[model samples]
Target: MSQTTIALTYDNLVNRIVPGPQSLSYFVPLVVLPIAFSIPPWIASKQTLCAVALPIISASLVHAWTVMGGIDVISFDMLLHSYHLLLFNDPRRHFRRILAKTATAEKTRTPKVGSRDGKDESTTPQYIEQPYPAKWSGRLPWIGTLLISMRFVDWKIGSPSHDSKQPDRNPTAPSHLRFILTAILRTLSGYVVLDLTSAWTQQDPYFKTFGVSVDSPLPQYALSGLLPPRLIRCTIMALQVWASVGQQFQLPCTLPVALHWMGYLPDAWSPHLWPTFFGSFRATFTTPNLGAVRNFWGRYWHQTLRYYCSGSGVWLANLMRLPRRSQSRYLLISATTFFFSGIVHIGLVPPEPIFALKSANQIRWLILVFFWLQPVGFAFETAVSVVLHHIGTPRLIYTILNILWFTAWCCFVLPFLGEAGRNLGYWRVWPVPVSLWQGITLGKWLAWV
Candidate 1:
């Protein structure tokens, strides 16, 4: 050890994360306050509204981040809105722009008011007002607007709907019964995935082990001079991270839709508004190719953060006067997006002595490096795939080779993520309310027997 003594403890780290009970109050307002204020500007129907609204929103967001701890999900979410607001500067893009009134066939445009002489006295545009807004239809009260504006991830125009194959060009709104059923199923699936992963994690010695310093041995990751063990450990680490992140994003994402069903919020608030939210994360397995890695990040992953993460890069690229859709611009956006992702996640790392980290900066460095390497890997994967195709590799053999290469790539880089995650106490939190796996393993199930 480098004789640099850092004064920190495990309990200090744990204390920094606000407990679940205390977090709800902070969480609600962190999400709601911004949307509440945003509605007026949204109603004003001015894109410039975000200009005035964003600074205030950004201040509150920064204040919340400073005060809060361990509520990464919504915290990152609010920041995305702030970035979108700052960069896009369009209130309509941030929130769904609904009509003041629902339009019937007659009220689709301006309506004519006739005097007793049957001549039009006044003709003013009228929109239909509805109890519930349809999928493609518009018209909602201010309250309905508030509900719709609160959403962070699903894009009004580009987002995929209930059927991933179908874009929003012809949207289909599921029936209330079907929508609720889907929400319930998704909620249950998320819970089971989380609970199972938590149970396995609690049993895994990887989470139990920690090093005294960054240089100290971390047996969980096979820090010793060993290859096979390191590969095994890294592979397991990747799977655990994948499962944990999937459920974490899935659980919170389903809540708004479920509430929509319960509160009878609005048809505009229905799954038709965001079908992808119901299944935001797609299955990871795909035919191994250049698109495999791209698809994993772009399609299979939960894209809640994609909008603002990429938007920050887009803003920067534009500021640099890069040509639109140029290779350099694409690379810059990709790098910036991953870099922002790293910055967002770095918030999870507390002061040192949390885990193996000697100083918080050590973990921070690892976090940034881990994310920064992603674009490098993506570019390399694309180049290699092209070379393989040019060399006349058989499709089946090429795919198999790509799978191995990707798995090996994951094994190489995922240890950085595993290390950062551990230092941040990621594996410590058990999000599930009740522990069925604990009950089973501990024989608490005997009571039911």
Candidate 2:
């Protein structure tokens, strides 16, 4: 065979032998669900899906509450756009691929000192020398480990080569801009539809509550109350945008930075302006009790679905129509996706005081619960697999593990934390009514409403 053909064959062989870096990077996070399942029965008894689901469900309810209160549709648009941007902009993948290539190069460059140089440097028997520098240990720093692991995976998976011979091309513009614009337009349209639908649906209730005629404009009492609704809606949208952005980028993964920003933003603005902006935006979106609930649901559904669909490679591949065979592949992929979801949740963590508030406290608790549950849950799964003969229900097992893990954490772990429990509240409030709006949108439009 020609040199080129031989090289190509070798490359293909190497690619087939090595797993993708993206896949390997996911291993750390994906183990969380299995860890949850591995918990002891006594601990498992304390876990209930409702504990995990309720806070999330409540948060969704509050998001709708704010929307119904009257936040501008644009605010929601901006928030979603930010999230999409962060999701696609992760640089870790590229960084890993680079490291992997460098390693491969270094390995190939090992020196045969005596033979190559035409000098006998050593009289002793020839032995393979270590490729790494003597001054440096083979052990990598934690961060270095992550980067190197990522690179190894990338190279093995046939990532594009970065050799100098490959001429650089002008980088392509991000497709995210188009997605952002589309999301904005879609969100705006949905907002309009929501308003119109609410108007018609709310006619009877408005008449009954305010003792006013349905054919005419809102009565004075209702008009007076409208401003608060609008303000609440804007607040919800802003929070959703902020939370979603943080989650997508894994910004909150740096806990200290996230806390600083959360505390800083609210304090930086003029108190009056903050409330006014929030109120006006909320009014624009049309917030009220029920409307707020609907908006909360909408944002919840949006975040949850987005996290599940795109946050992990496995889920993204499946959602985007990539093929997978065998139950193990599916389990592996789902675990990876779930791990990413946890990272997103970590990004959403709030400061101590903010977490102490009732709603935020619940979310904070949920986050902590999941954090501890990840490893323990996986260990539990390994133990169970040893005894169980069937492995046909990996997905079901994962789900059960999550449910049990959260339940145990909430009941046994949380109560012991004392004041730590106080840290469970939300920094932002979303009204419960948004859930209704979300349901209507999904049922009728077959899309996130």
Candidate 3:
């Protein structure tokens, strides 16, 4: 669905991922490291301490979880083969023959016992192609990234707290300060929206009743027959989308702004970071785009997880020899990427205690089903878009249709998703920023008056 991928520099350490006997150990560091580094800067007071402390712990655990779990490396070929063998006792005996042929060709092309250049080639083993980060020129980008990351950390550790003095209004700071302040307030509002959503369905009785897995093979979405469940699903999904804007922008984005104003975050990371993380929520929340599934996902919802997920699809599509632009290729890519995403979502459950997210095995699979179900819907959307575009429909009509389509899809799927997410304790997960909202709202009302 969302073809975004974050560039990871490492490869997988294993053929498959499963809970280990000491898998519980993965949870240990997330808790220990945060508490270990719990010191806040001198600027932090009682009210603002948790705000500063929480992001550090979150970014640390998410980073650590990626490294320790081999979340960065996913071999779709090997993964698919493993699943096939486990589920159906099929080892894909065909790939073995292809591999054998490939080995023979390489051997035949190389120096042999009686070949002319055999001795020379064998004597001098040339490094034909080196992997990333091995060459002199290759290190420049990474060097730049390193410098930026250091600057980011420096700013984060020294950023101004909630109780700290504010920047000068137009009379005190530079003109650009206005933009930064606006963003901070905006993202803070987003977090407020998220808090509201969490409060709505925090106890999810139906989700608790469903317990470990789906009650039937199919979901019992129409709780009060059809209308009531759909309406509730619609409302929650709207709130969820609203909250996502806040969660993504409010914390990760605003903290940097506070730092930048306090002379911590550099100009380099600030400008681009806010739009990518914070403004993404707007892409989903705004009119004409909200229910447009393809754009909403491709543009809005897909900021962080694309680079990893899409590689699997592109690689697999190549193997399948599915040509680009064909409906078959589109469907195959969507299916593969979404399924891998299901795997990734399962991995997202920090191998820790079940605190915010549902980490139990059976519940994890149900959560994964939320991801796994996406491709079919996306594929359907792709087909409809293609047909409508070919008939030369007006762009406005095309968009309206897509919006309706998107709304219907959300109504169908979000009931299942809302339940799963709420079950994971996503309800009221983050602390509410009461002062931020109150201040912003008061300023707005005063300006209006």
- The model with the greatest TM-score is 1
Ranking by TM-score: 1, 3, 2
The digit string of per-residue lDDT tens for model 2 on 289-341 reads 11222232223223323333333454355456655554454444445544544
Write down the TM-score of every candidate: 0.63, 0.23, 0.50
The number of the candidate with the highest lDDT is 1
Instruction: Give stretches of model 2 more than 4 Å off.
Output: 1-171, 174-239, 242-323, 326-328, 343-362, 365-449
Worst 10 residues of 3 by lDDT: 92-101
**Which runs of model 3 end up more than 4 angstroms from their true locations?**
1-179, 202-227, 244-247, 254-268, 273-275, 278-291, 319-322, 348-359, 390-392, 428-449
Model 2 error, position 190 (Å): 19
Model with the higher TM-score, candidate 1 or 3: 1
Lowest lDDT 10-mer window, candidate 1?
Answer: 161-170
The residue-by-residue lDDT of candidate 1 on 1-449, one tens digit each, is 11233334444533343211223343443554345444443354444545554556666655655554433445666667565654444433343443333344344544444322244433332433232223323323433343334333222323233123322321445544555566567556665666676665555556544642323333563336654555655655665555455534434434565677577554444443453532323233345454455556766666656766777777777789998758788788889789888877766664433334446668778877888898887788768777877887665775566566667777677777767666666666565656577577775532224
**lDDT-best of 2 and 3:** 3
